[model samples]
Each structure stands twice: as C-alpha cells, then as structure tokens.
Target chain A: MSTTVVNTGTEGKTWGGGNEPLKASYGKMMMWFFIVSDALTFSGFLAAYGFSRFKFIESWPIADEVFTHVPFLHGQELPMIYVAFMTFILIMSSVTMVLAVDAGHKMNKTKVTWYMFLTIIGGLIFVGSQAWEWATFIKGDYGAVQTKGGNILQFVDTDGHRVALGDFVVAEHKDRTAHERKNGLWFVDEGTLPTYTVDEVIKGLESHENVLVRTQIINEEGEKTVLSRAESLKQIKENGKAVVEGANLYVNEYGSPLFADFFFFITGFHGFHVFSGVVINIIIFFNVILGTYEKRKSYEMVEKVGLYWHFVDLVWVFVFTFFYLV
Target chain B: MGHEHKLEILRGLIKFKSNTQKIWGVLILLSIVTAVEVVLGIYKPEALMTQVLSMKLLNWIFIILTIVKAYYITWDFMHMRDETKALRRMVVWTAVFLICYLVFILLQEGGYIEGVYSSGFVKRDF
Candidate 1:
C-alpha cells in the first residue's frame, strides 16, 4: 500500500461527506428532519379527521355553529372570532421566535432574551386559550337528545333559534340516580348522569309550543332538517333514548360523536406540541440568560429551536383551517 | 457565521431590508389571510357556496389560503429559504407529496364508506 493518502478533491465541496453537504450544521439538519417527520405525523391525524368528516358528510356539524362561544361573551353568537384571535396569537409568537433567531445571528443577547420572552408569553396565552375552548366544548351550551339510532336531536324555536334544554326542561321527582361502585356493582361504575333525562326532555317538548326538534341530517340547503311539530313530538316520544350534554369520546351533543373525538385528539396533540415548545424555549431561555451561547460565539441553538417553534405554528395554521374555517 | 437571508417574498415582488423586517412582513401577510378567512367564514357568501370540483368554492379558497400561510411559515419563519436547495427540497417535497397522497386516499375511502353505510344493510337514515 502506498504511504501517500489519496485525494478525491471533494473536501469543502457541496457533495463532501463531512463538510456540511446541506450547508446546515448537524444539529440544524437533524432538526429539519425531525420537523419533516412530525409534519407527516400531523398530516396523518388530519387526514384521519378528513376521513371521518367525509364519512358523515351529510350529518356533520357546522364548525361556525359549534364554535360560537367567546370568552366573557355569554349568550352571544359570535362565531370564528375567538379562534381567529387564537390564530393571531400563535402567528405573533412565531414572528417573535424568528426575530429571536435573527437577534441570535447578530449575537444580540438582549434582543434575543426579550424576543424569546415574548414568544414564550404568546405560546402560554395560546395554550391557555385552547384550554378555555376545550372547557367550553366539554361544558356544552345547548344540550341535545340522542336517538336510539345514535343521532343528535336539537331543539329550535319557530324562528330557527337554538333553545337550550335548561330553558324548558322541568325536572320530575324520581328515585333513579347514577350508578356507583359503592351503591351497586363492586367493580363497575357508571359515568356521571346528564342533568336532565330523556323523558323530561319529551315532556318539555310536549308543553313548549314554539320549540321543535332538529335532526342531525342536513337538508338541501345545508341546514339541519327540522321536523314538523307533530313529527317532532312523535320522534322524541318514540326514538329519544338519552339526554346528551357536552362532548366526550362516546357521546357528543354535536351532530356526530366522531367530531368530538377528532377535535379532542388533533387539538390535544397540537397543544402538546405547543406545550413542549414552551418548555424547550424556557430551557434555552435560561441558557441565554447564563451567556451560554455568548461564550460559544454561535446562536445556532436558538435557530434550531426556532425551527421547532415555527413548525408548531405551521401545524396550527392547518388545524385552524381544517377545524374552524373549512 | 456569515448567514445571509433572501429577504424578498411574493416572487421578489416584495423585499425587506432585514430578517427582522421580513418576519414582520410575513406576519402581516398571515394575519391578513387569517382575517380574510374569518370574514368569509362568518359571512359564508352564497356565491362561493356553489360546488366546484365536488367541493364548495369557499372551502377551496380556505384550503388554498391555508397552504399559502403554511408556505410563508416554512419558507420565512423556519428559514428554509436560506438553507441549501437540497435541504429545502428534502423537507418540502417529501411532506407535500405524502400529505397529498394520504389526504386523497383517505377522502376517497371515506366517500366509499359513506356509500356503503347508506346502501348496505345498515341504513343510516332513521
């Protein structure tokens, strides 16, 4: 073997094996790879959501009608406003994150610290807003009745305004109560009972002259099919099986149970991403304060984390579109 | 550590002085898109409700706008534009192709399942 080393003349070129072929550091390139994989994971979830929505195309709930509540604005039907605000908050955080990266490039520690702080604040606000939205979704506004065939039956007045079950439901004195493990079965316990029973809803429907039943089925005009008064009474008395309040994996006062499942799963997943992003930001934030990057003379760490943060915001844009707007 | 950014957006129709400025510009564009989406969602114009390619025109607009927002968030916010061409292609092309395939297959399957639900022994209508 020759003592002289062979030269391929590929060193420092774009195709060089170890010379940063992508013009990105190992850590930053790995971050991009992670982000791409994560993007596919989110797309899987969203496509599953699309599958379910298309499966129940005719009976799917309208997002505008479902997500109408706003913070501190009770009894008002303002749709899409609160969600729009949340989108703005996430986008603003993303902007601050990129600014932090820009500051990192310039080795401006103070600017990076402040911008990172602002980005963290924006993320916290977004997570908090999402929690509020989830709470409201769980504690649903207007309760609906579930038919034996697993369909939602909502109450509406003559003017097509939704009427809450609480407005007209009259509780009848009954000895029946929720089944508890201590009360009956030693190993089985039932879920919390809804406030009102199906019979009570039927009774209220009979007494209320203006209230009518709206089926989950959509008509030609893309509205829920409202039954005639007589048909409404017959439907409730004969088919109504239980009163459903709020949303759960099994039951939803919305049109389909699948809708609630997807909402909880997809948004819950994205919220987890936001939460982890905040935690990572906090860790890097402390490092910045301690002059870790200042000593290293490179803020590439900040740029890597910024990529993750921006990925979270990107996912949210799609989530907001598929969940709310579309 | 000489990191340079391509600071022009909208096919170089708009240019910015610095990375910070570019971020703000992208933010403004995203916010405007979101505002337009919110307004359309709230109003739900009848003209846009008409079906096009088996979907409502309004939905098509929303999806297109969402893609646009995603583009800016990736290209600008994530600094994909400044990265090497190989890196950008590796991330963007893989994601776009796989997502489109997944969505197409799932949606088609869902429509088929709906047909089965309606026409099969298990009747959906009560």
Candidate 2:
C-alpha cells in the first residue's frame, strides 16, 4: 500500500488551490473586497437617509433654500455653486491621484511626488471647505421659531424676502443666571439661553407689519406657505414655544430636526473619510519621498490609495445627488 | 500594471503614451457631467419636474447622471478598466446587487410610512 500524499494538481503550499483565479495579487483582491464592504456600509447610511426623507417629504426643507450660502459672497442666494465647486475639486484630486499611480508604474519618482502633493493639497481644500459648509449650516442665517408641535416657523416679508430676527427684534437685556450642574440642586443644569425668547420674536413680528410667518410646508406654487398677517399673529401667539436660532441635534432652524441630524451625520462621515484619505496620502507621499516603492520596483501602494480616493469621490457624487440635487 | 505594461487608457481608443493626459481627459468628462447636474439642480426646469414612473423626471435624471459619473470614476480613475474581467465583475456586480436590494427594502418601507402619514390614520402631530 502506497501511503504517499497525492499532489492533487495543487502543488503550491498556499490556499485557493494554488491559482490566482482573478489574475490579481493578494493585496489588490483584498483591497477590492474591503471596498465592496465599505460601499455597502455607505449604501446603508444613504438608504436610511432616504427613508427618513421620504417619511417627511411634505415638510422637508428645500435643498436650494437650505444651502444658499457661498463662501466670500455672504448673504447671497447662490444655490448649488459652492457644492459643485467642492465636487469639482475632489474629482480633480482623484485625477491627480491616478496620475501619481501612473507615474509610480513608470518608476518616475519626481512625477509621482508632484502628483501626490497636488492630491494632498486638493484633499486639504475639500476638508476645509466642508468644515466651512458645516459651520455655516450650524450657525444658520435667519432665525426661526419652534412651535410646541416641533415645527420651525420662519419670517418672510411681503416681498417674499427673508427677515432676520436681529433686524426687527428689539434687543432687551435682563439679568439672568445659568444653572450649572455643580451649583444647582440635584445636579441638573439649564440649557444655554437663546438670543431671544418667543415673546421677543412675537413682539418683533407685531412691530413689523410687513413680516409674515412661513411654515415649512410647500404650497401649490412650489414656495413655502406664508401665513397672512392676522394668521401669523394668531399662530405665533398660540403655538410659539422657543426661539430656535441655529441647528443642533435637538433643533434646526431649517425645517425638520432630522434634516440637521442627517446632514451632520452623513456629511461628517464623508468628511472623516476624506480626512483619513489625506492622512494615508501623506504617509504614501512620505514613502514615495523615501524611495521605498522605487526600491521594490513597484508603485502598487499608490495605485491602491488611488482606488480609495476615487471611491471617496464616487460616494460624494451620490451624496451630492441625494442630498442636494434631488 | 507592472513595469513592462504601458499605462494606456480608454481601452486604447486614445493611447496615452504618458497616461497623464488620459487622467485629465477623464477628469474633464466627469466635470462636464457634474456641471450639467448642478445646472439642472439650480434651474429645475418645469418640464422635468413632472411626475413619471412614481418619481419626478428631474430626480431620475440626477440619479442616472450620478451613476454615469460613478462609473467613470471607477472605470477610469480607479483603473478598474485595466483589471481582469473576472475581478471587475466580482467587485462591481456584488456591490450593484446589494445596493439595489437595500434601496428596494428601505424605499418600499419609506413609501409605506409616507402613506400612513398622509392617510391621517396615524396621529403624528404631537
């Protein structure tokens, strides 16, 4: 009896029966697999966002009205321009990343370095612009009032122009003390005070007869539903609870509180990706400077990072569509 | 690609001896698509906003254009076009299937919720 182990046509000592079925190396294939899973994670988040948006379709904030600010052009109604520019910049960074990968293929360290530098710069600009956008969104433009039913009520003049709270709200100051956890009984603390109370906003509305209350609901004319002068006074006097000046997890001056939550979560997640991408690019940039890949006779690492950068850009495309365009 | 293979792009339709030019070309295509998307979003022409197939026509355009842009970014910038066919299918097909399934489930449920909200059976006006 022959007890010799048969070759079984798999002579190598590795897995996969000793064949690269996809014709890709171990690293590249694993990277692709990781990307697929990550893509699914992002899809899950986007799907949740879609569900919530659909749930509140009628009262959802209009993307144009919410994202009207453009940097260096304060108080201008420039819709979709700044986000488009951010998209363009990220796409260009992906281009430079691919160029770096191509240069790495040729063992041209100089070109690789230059392209990698440009990619890093582009990433920095994207992250910075995103921060600016978030700040602007959080700080909100014109303040609004929240109803007891948790609806945001904005003010618009007779000409359909928005009116700021500070424009007409008389700034009356009264001595007030914040209750701190340490100083207060039972270790509870009062929340931060808003710039104005509901009474102040109601008084402001009464003083300015031209101002009207605009609800978040859309009318048949595709504009916000603006109440009549009489209705505005009645609505404010009856339903107004607190003055909501900006966006947070609990309140939003835009429309729905969920809108602010999703905006912060989704965009913050994407920005985190861009942040990590920049860090990875910087590490690879240093490796290129060190001539490590050159010595290895391959620039596949740069190519891998290029894959990730492009994926980030791809995700942004969908985000821009779902969050802004659609 | 290894040291021996040249970095040609566009399936050799436009042979980039340097590969840098091909990168720029792909970028331009993506930028054009994005420009169109932004213009459509800002203007939102009346005709396109008409309802069609359970969704607005403008929204469909945005989704389709977004998919096109994603394809280009993956195929060109990520060098998926240069990889083996089996690898491409394995990665792209799997993602497509899962994403479609996920969107189907969530959006179906979302429509149900919307119906409930509009039907006035559920008291959400707290």
Candidate 3:
C-alpha cells in the first residue's frame, strides 16, 4: 500500500486560519472572535454611558435609589434585593450551561438535556424580571417639575415623605379646543399633555404649606437638597418650567434625562442579548432532544453554544456591577 | 488535538478528577465573590469610601472584584485555562487593550467637558 501526502507549501505557518495553529477548533475560535468584537461594542456603549454620567456626577441619580422597586411588593423600598435575585439566577444559569457542556463531553445525553432545561428556565425568569423592572421604571412613582435650570424639583412633606402629584396637585382643566385635521391644522396635533401643568404645580405647592421642594443636586449628606418653604415657593414660582410626570427620552422624574436614556439603552441592549440567547438555547435544546449531536458522534455544538451562553452571562456581570453596584 | 486534560485551578492549588466537580467548584467560588460584591454595595462601608486615586476605594474594589468574576467566567467556564496560550492571548488581549483605551479616552474627554460646564463659562442650568 502506497500513501502519498502533498504539502501546499503553506504548512507549519499561521498565515491561513485552517491549520488550527492555536489548537482551537474552528467553530470555537470563531465564537471567540465574535465575542471579542461583541465585547468591544458593549464597551463602547458602557463607556459613553460613563461619560455622560461623569458629566453630571454630582446630580447623577444613585443607582440604588433608582432601581428600588420589587414586583408584587409595591410601596416597599427593597433596594437591590430583586436585582440580586436576578443576578443569582443568571449565574446559576451559567453554572447549568457549563454543566451541560461537561455532560456533553462525557457523552451523557440525559444529564445534558436536564442541565439545558435548567439553563433555559433560569434565563426565562431573568428576562421576565427585567421586563417587570422596566415597567416599574417607566410608570414612575413620584412626579416632579423641571426647573428652568434643567434640574428636577421633587415634592416632599415636612416629614420628608415623597408626595405624588396626584396626592396634592388639584389641576383645573382649561377648556381649550383640540386641534383637528378638518380645522386646517392637520400636522399640528398637540403633544400629549402632562398630568399637571407648571401653573398647576406652582398652585399646588402654594396650597400645601407643609410640602417643600427637593432639588436633584445631591448635597454633602448624599441626599437631594431640600429647600425651605419660602425657598420652595420662590424657586417654583420663578423657575418651574415644565411639569414632568414620568420618564421618557426627554424627561425623567428620577433626575437627569441622560440617566433614563442610558438606562433604557444599555439594559434594553442586554435584554436583547438575553432574548436571543434564549431563542438560540431553545433551538439547541430541541436539537439535543432529537439526538442530533449523538448522530454526529461529537457534542462540539453544545460546547460552542455553551461558550456564547457564558459570554452573555459574563457581560451581565459587568453590567450588573457598573449599572447597579458602581 | 493533543488535549491537555490536567484540570487544575488557582495555579494548581486544587485539582478536580472530573469536569463536573470542577464546574461546581468554580460556581461556588464565583457565587462567593458575587455575595461579597452585593454586601459591599448594600452596606457601602464608609471607611472604604474615602477617595483614593481620584475615585472611592470601594469603587476600586468593585471594579477589581468584577474583573475577578470576569476572569473566572472566561478561564473556567469557557475553558480558557485549558486552551493553548496563543488562543488565550489572542482573545483576552484584544478585548483588554481596546476596552482600556476606549474608557481612558472617553473619561478624559468627559472630565474636560465637566470642567467647562462648572467653570462658570457656560450657563447650562439657568
């Protein structure tokens, strides 16, 4: 028997990506390549967020204060508890993913299936919790007025408890005619009006003698600055420019509008990653049940997808730290 | 593939006979690290909050701990430690250098803009 081997003159060199010079499988290396580039994309977003946040560091909303809501336990100020739970779920999912990869390596189909199921469940819970958190943030708890200086003016009683606009502001509706297309102002629809107007806010402040205004600027004590009764009246009467009921791209009851923008963008981006990860995992889960990898005699597909799942979890670790902890 | 299957961690301080056990070990280690982070974030010890190197000491701790978590997730969960040195460096170095560079430039420019705003030249709030 004669065996002839031909060398294409490019052997023993790392010019082409075919030779496995780094001893990594092609698919694994590609996953790493995608991860590195995806990592840079995430870094860009987080860095820009950091820039805007540093610009208004003094008045930047404290993350602990902003992400204080928990589902089903309304009106309770449980800061970081739900987020911590979400973090734990995600980490546990990563653990399950790695375990699945390990089972795949051992050629244990049953264990791999169970671990994948667990990972998928964990991911679903985290995404659901994130959606609930987003809703709570959008609805907002306390309404605020935007000062002409672009700072937020929150209301509080003498006891320092936050007062919602609905609790004190008794706004009288003006009988203004609505703009209609038939009236020759087709493109001139009025913007959705806020629940209360600036005048209504000032009137409410004047009526509630016990209520004072709290500025967004954090004082030396690490709390928002509270103005005295007379100062509140003067500032609101002079500087109140717009009534902001809740959060949107332009206005945020929490404080800085940039906070809302970054919050929405970064978390939304991460949520998208989780969503896709879930979809991919579901596909892989179905394939695993069909014995697809078993027919191939190698579970490298499971391992490759496991790499992506872990990377997503890794990114979330940083997001949780920067967005919540830092 | 000439697999290097010596499953050891922490510079060979601990070795696992099975990959599953190793995964659990890494998971426990990561969980402890996260627990410490959550505690520090919740309590935020006042003593550790004193400014150091233009930032709070606790913030530095948070960043350091986050890096540690990232390292374990990559090296252990992703099997980077078992990978060849070239592949490891290729992925890790690319990400590390780019992220550091981007953060440095952005934060520097941001600080400059902040100074401009606070120097009484631009009236943003009024």
Candidate 4:
C-alpha cells in the first residue's frame, strides 16, 4: 500500500501552518507568553503581601527604621539611601541589557559583548547588595521584646530615640546552659538563645530612668505609641514574654512576623530571578563570543533574554515601591 | 534581522536619535522618578501624610511613579512598543486586569478581617 500527502492550499495564509499572525517567531511568542504568566505569579505574591499589610496596618513595621543600615556605615540611621542605591544598580543593568539587545539587532558582536559584560557586572552588584541587606536585617540593630499578645515593645529614650538592649541590659551569669542532643532528648535540640533574657531587660528598664516603652500600635499621629514611664514599666513587667534579637519566620524585632516573611519570600524570589538571568546572560555571552549567533545570522537569542532581564527589573521596581517606599 | 525602533517617548514629547539613545533616555527618566520617590519617602512631608481614599498621599504618589517606571521598562526596554497591537494587548491587558481584580478582592477581604479583629468579637490580642 502507498500513502499520499495532502495540502489544503492555504499554507501561506494567516491561519495556515508557518504563518506569523503576531509577526513574532515561535520562540519570541513563547517568551512573551511565559512573561505574562510570570507577571501574574508575581502579582499574586504582591497582592498577598498587600493583604497582610492591610490586615496589620495599625502595627506594621516602619520600612525606614528597619532598612537603616548601609555597608561599612555602622550606627548611622540613613534610611532609604542604600535601597535607593540598589534600585539604581538594577535600573542601570536593565539599561545595559537593552543596549546589548540593540547591539545584537545590528549584529555588532563587539558592542553586544561589551554591553552584555556591563549588564552582568551590574547584576552581580545588585545581588551582592541584596545579600548584604538581608544580613543587616537578620542581624537586627536594636533588640525588642515580644509580648504575650504577639506585639513588639521597643525601648526608647524620653526624647523618642530608639535605645538598644545592649546599651543598658546588665548580663547576669546564671549558668544558663543550651539544650543539646546529648544532654536533652536524643532527637531534640534547642534553637539559639537570645542575647539577653526578658527579666534582664525588665531590670535594665527599671534602672534606666529615661527609658520608655514604645508599642507597635500606631497612634493618631501615625507613630508607634510611646507609653509613659510608669505605664512602660507596668506593661513590660506584666506582659513581656521573650527577648527577640532579629528577624525570622516566627519572630521579628521589626514589629510584625508577616512583614519579615514577605520581605524574605518576595525579595528572595526576585533575587533568584536575577541570579538565573545572570547565568543565562553568561551563556549567551559565551555563545556570542563563539560566533554562534553570527553564524546563525540572528541575534534574537539576546533579545529574548533581554526581555527576561528587563522583566526582572520591572518586578524590582514594584517590589521596591511596595516593600520600601509604600 | 534589523527592525526600526520607535524613538520617541512620553507621548512624542521627547525623541532620541537611536535605540541606544532611547534606552539611556528612559534610564534617566526612571532614575529621576526613583530619586523623587526616595526623597519623598525620607522626608514624608507633613502635607502628603493626609489620608486620601484610605491611603496616604505620599503612598499614592509612590505607586503612580512605580507604575510609570513599569510602563517605560515594558514599552521601551522590553520593546513592547515595537510589537503588534495584538501581542501587546495579549501580554499587558491580561496581566493588568487580573492583577487589579486580585488586589481588589484580597484587600477588601483583608479589611473585613481587620474589622472583625478590632470589633472585639475575635480576641486576637491578650
């Protein structure tokens, strides 16, 4: 038996096979579709974050106070400066990425290579900055106490300036031993203990006449509620349960646990995207150097990856606004 | 393949000589917007602190500027403006519509939950 091929005589039409309806190649169209889906995923994360913030609008952590540290500048309360620098770095990298794509469009190999190199360098700097920011956040500057009601109570001087527990807490040698697998249950071990005990903090508060307690709840003037000296002593002595040093999933000295959770989750996800974008750029960079695109007579690969890189930057713009600015 | 780039931005108010120039121009615009945002955030002018439609005026400004930055990044840097109208709408309209709906529903629900928490019916705090 024999088989014969059939053609519908519409092979070159818009709806026919191999027709470019959107005037985009299969790879580019697929990239656009992927980007749309990815945008939705990011939006879901951001919307959830917004929901949580709305829920705790009265007691949310102040972004400025939390992101005050800059590299090599200890004890300086310069808020929004470091984050602004990170934003500039990401935006600059995005600019370089588009430059690389433009050079690729012209099939200028030297220009493409140089722009790609700059873009990769910018990405590395942004990632490094993010890591440093995470470190500063996790190793909190001024420790606070977590009350039984899950609220944070921070110490402040009479003038409303924050006071660190390390400034006043007197350490007592009380033979406090860490629980280990060898000494305790075979499968159980305790997490790292806080720097100071709640009782120690209370005793320090009692001795420090100028110190007051500030609750997480925002008052009429849109600031954390600072209680009077007698009220501060009463609140801390009665309700304070644990000393919180830094941020984590369960506890954060930065007012709300949800804030830290979203901070880690959202920024971590975006950082992962930046990292993968850099890796892909490196691969494309090597391919350009090897004359792969020159031989293929098309540098659309660079354009495709450039779209992804710009998308990463776009997400960061929103993240920076929502996480830090708003 | 060589394709012509749309060189003008800001509704034809500004034009660039080439695609590279346009990229730099958009970068400058974005940087300026970010700087303004940082200044407002740091200073938090007392006038902008007034609540408008349940949000601070400063927050509104930041969100609008952020959207402006996103638009330029997509239209210029991603070359969305060069694409066909169908493709642009397919990518943009879908995300925008869905995200707005999701945010609306979630925020409303969050507000309701907050009311419940604060109304003394649910004792969340000790």
Q: Is candidate 2 or candidate 4 better by DockQ?
A: 4
Candidate 2 per-residue lDDT, tens place, A161-207, comes to 99988888886785766677787686686777788888888889999
Candidate 4 docking band? high
* CA lDDT, candidate 4, residue A316: 97
User: How far off is residue A225 in model 4, in Å?
Assistant: 0.5
Q: List, residue by residue over B28-91, the lDDT tens digit for candidate 1.
A: 8998999999999999999998999989999999999999999899999988888889999998
Clashing residue pairs in candidate 3 (N, C-alpha, C atoms within 3 angstroms): A149-B125
- Fnat, model by model in order, equals 0.85, 0.87, 0.79, 0.86
Q: Model 4, stretches more than 4 Å misplaced?
A: A1-3
Residue B58 shift from truth in candidate 1, angstroms: 0.2
A1-326 in candidate 1: lDDT tens per residue? 69787777897776766766677788998998999899999999999999999898989999988999999999899999999999999999998999999999999999999999999999999999999999999999999999999999999999999999999999888788989989898898889899999989988998899999999988889889999999999999988998999998999998799999999999999999999999999999999999999999999899999999999999999999999998
Per residue, candidate 4 scores C-alpha lDDT tens digits across A1-326 of 25655777888787778766688888998998999999999999999999998888888998988999889997899999999999999999998889888888888999999999999999999999999999889989899999998999999999999999999898788678788899979999787898899899999999999999999988889889999999999999999999999898889998999999999999999999999999999999999999999999899999999999999999999999999999
From the highest DockQ down, the ranking of the candidates is: 4, 1, 3, 2
Q: Is candidate 2 or candidate 3 better by TM-score?
A: 2
Which residues of candidate 3, in runs, are more than 4 Å off? A1-18, A174-192, B1-6
State the lDDT of candidate 4 residue by residue for B22-42, as single tens digits: 888998899999999999999
Candidate 3 lDDT score at position A115: 93
lDDT of 3 by residue, A170-220 (tens): 879776555666776777766456778888888888888999998888887
Runs in model 2 with CA error above 4 Å? A1-17, A182-186, B1-18
